[model samples]
Target: MKKYRIGIVGATGAVGQEIISLLEKREFPVAEARLLASANSAGRQMQACGNLETIQETTADSFKDLDIAIFSAGSKQSLEFAEASRQHGCVVIDNSSAFRMDPLVPLVVPEINPDDLEKHQGIIANPNCSTAVALMGLYPLHKRFGLKRFIASTYQAVSGAGAAGFDALENELKAQFVPEENSSTATKDSPFPHPIAHNLLPHIDDFREDGYTKEELKMKNESRKILGNPSLKVSCTCVRVPVYRAHSISLSAEFSQPVNVPDAKAAIEGFNGAELWDLPNANRYPTPLQYAEKEDCGVGRIRIDQAFDNGLSLWVVGDQLWKGAALNAIQIAETLVEKKCLKWM
Candidate 1:
């Protein structure tokens, strides 16, 4: 196997940091590893592979010699630099919404559609964390029953918003100790509209004309792309929970044929990136707290849905920072290499 030269944009941010750790943890063949950040954050040293390397300022020249560039920067940054990175002959796996909807770029979930990697024009888009987690359960069932529609309610962790969201939750919870900051206005500048400590925010992103938040729409749009189901209807409600890591989604998916609980469990058990953990009698189900930092997305609370004739209800959870973002991007890069779509260094 030929080692590839890799670069990471947004190396200091939440998802970016996870990509760094995953690349090391997965033992990705690395001819060289380069870290890049904005000018303000450049010059900092990150310890990796038994050595400390200085983070370079991102420039047009940053991707000059790299084989793959993993981007976790915001959409605007991705919009501006992804093409530049690709122009420099680097394959960009972007963890931003900038290119997911683009006809030329592939929106991929390796377990669901690794074949999408073949259509990439040097850029591959990662699905939203909530969308990614929910489909882990939904896709397997779809394979058996043929998916037609889905309804989902997501319990997303604070970390999904990045470091600011996590910091806001941590600080607000800390403010409770001061005895004078218990009021709602104490965390007014927080990422959420209300204090997210011990509270749930129904809104996850900016409200669209239809009243669905951007995060909610992401679930609808992204799932359709990943599953190659353009007619797949998704109704989603994304809620921000006080949890700090994994994201959980409660969903009811209707299929083309009648669904069975035993068959659903078997399908999930056999799925590549999913697990069946439903045991109501034992009161055991997949929970965000339980699946934190884990690789496989967990599915539980499996049952036949009463609302639809051929539907199943289930709960799914996975660490968004991993299976949803970092690990997925790494897997796509690996798939490209394995298929020889991306050249070996």
Candidate 2:
């Protein structure tokens, strides 16, 4: 077993911090871990594997001598730094929309398309959170039954918007409970356009002229690429919920062949990286609160959808920061090593 010198861009952000925690928990053979953030966050210290590591400013030269760099920064940073990291001979796993639509770059989900890792040109793009969470349960079923169409409604958490979104939800909740000089003052500069404490916003990302949001379109396009089915039909309505972490999806999928409840449950249960919790008798089902802070996505509420003959309705919950972003990137990095695409540092 060999170790790799790893660097995490945007180390001070929420996803970046989760990457550090996951790398430690999974024992991913990291020889050295460098935390890099914006200039203001330089010299700030963060804990990784129980040792304090100082955050460095992200510059082109920062990637020198690094073997693997996991980037959770926004598109602006990824677009600016990804090529620089690759130019320094480092394998970059980017968790942003910057390169996902690139025909050359592989938009990957390890369990579904591990082979895509071999085609990477120094950078691999992690799928969006809503897309990732939906596919965690839907992909396995697609394998069992030929998937033709998919309609999903996402119950996304505030944390998906990063730290600012989380703070806004907290402040709103606190304002609702605590007395304030004026309620408006508490949520004057909320991260979201409206309150998220006791409300559900129908929009996730900016809406397009066609009525679908950017987040919703990511699900449609990314799913087709990952599934290798360009003709696949997918419609999604991504919503922002008040929860702190994790994301849930109500999926109704129609397959080429008829799928029964028992078969669907079996398909999900037998799949890797997914678990079935469809025990209606016990009133147990997947939820954001239950799957928060966990690795595996939970699938439950399995039943035949009444709308379509070959359709099944299922609910899935997964940690958006983990499987949706950090863990997925780490898994891709692991796949790169396992496939000999990247050498140990």
Over 1-345, each residue of candidate 2 has an lDDT whose tens digit, in order, gives 898999999888989989998998999998889999999999888788667899999999999999999998899999999989999999889998999989989999999999988888888899999889889899889988889998999999999999898898987777674434434332666667767777778988799999999999999999999999988999999999989999999999999997898888999989888889889899899888999989899999999999977999999999999999999999998889889987422
- Give the poorly placed runs of model 2, Cα more than 4 Å off: 177-186, 343-345
After superposing candidate 1 on the true structure, give the runs of residues whose Cα lies further than 4 Å from its correct spot. 177-189, 343-345
lDDT of 1 at 117: 88
RMSD of each: 2.0, 2.4
Q: Candidate 2 at 44: error in angstroms?
A: 1.0
Worst 10 residues of 2 by lDDT: 177-186
lDDT per residue for candidate 1 within 153-227, as digits (tens), equals 999999999988888888878777232364555365567777787678898889999999999999998988888
Q: All candidates' lDDT scores?
A: 0.89, 0.89
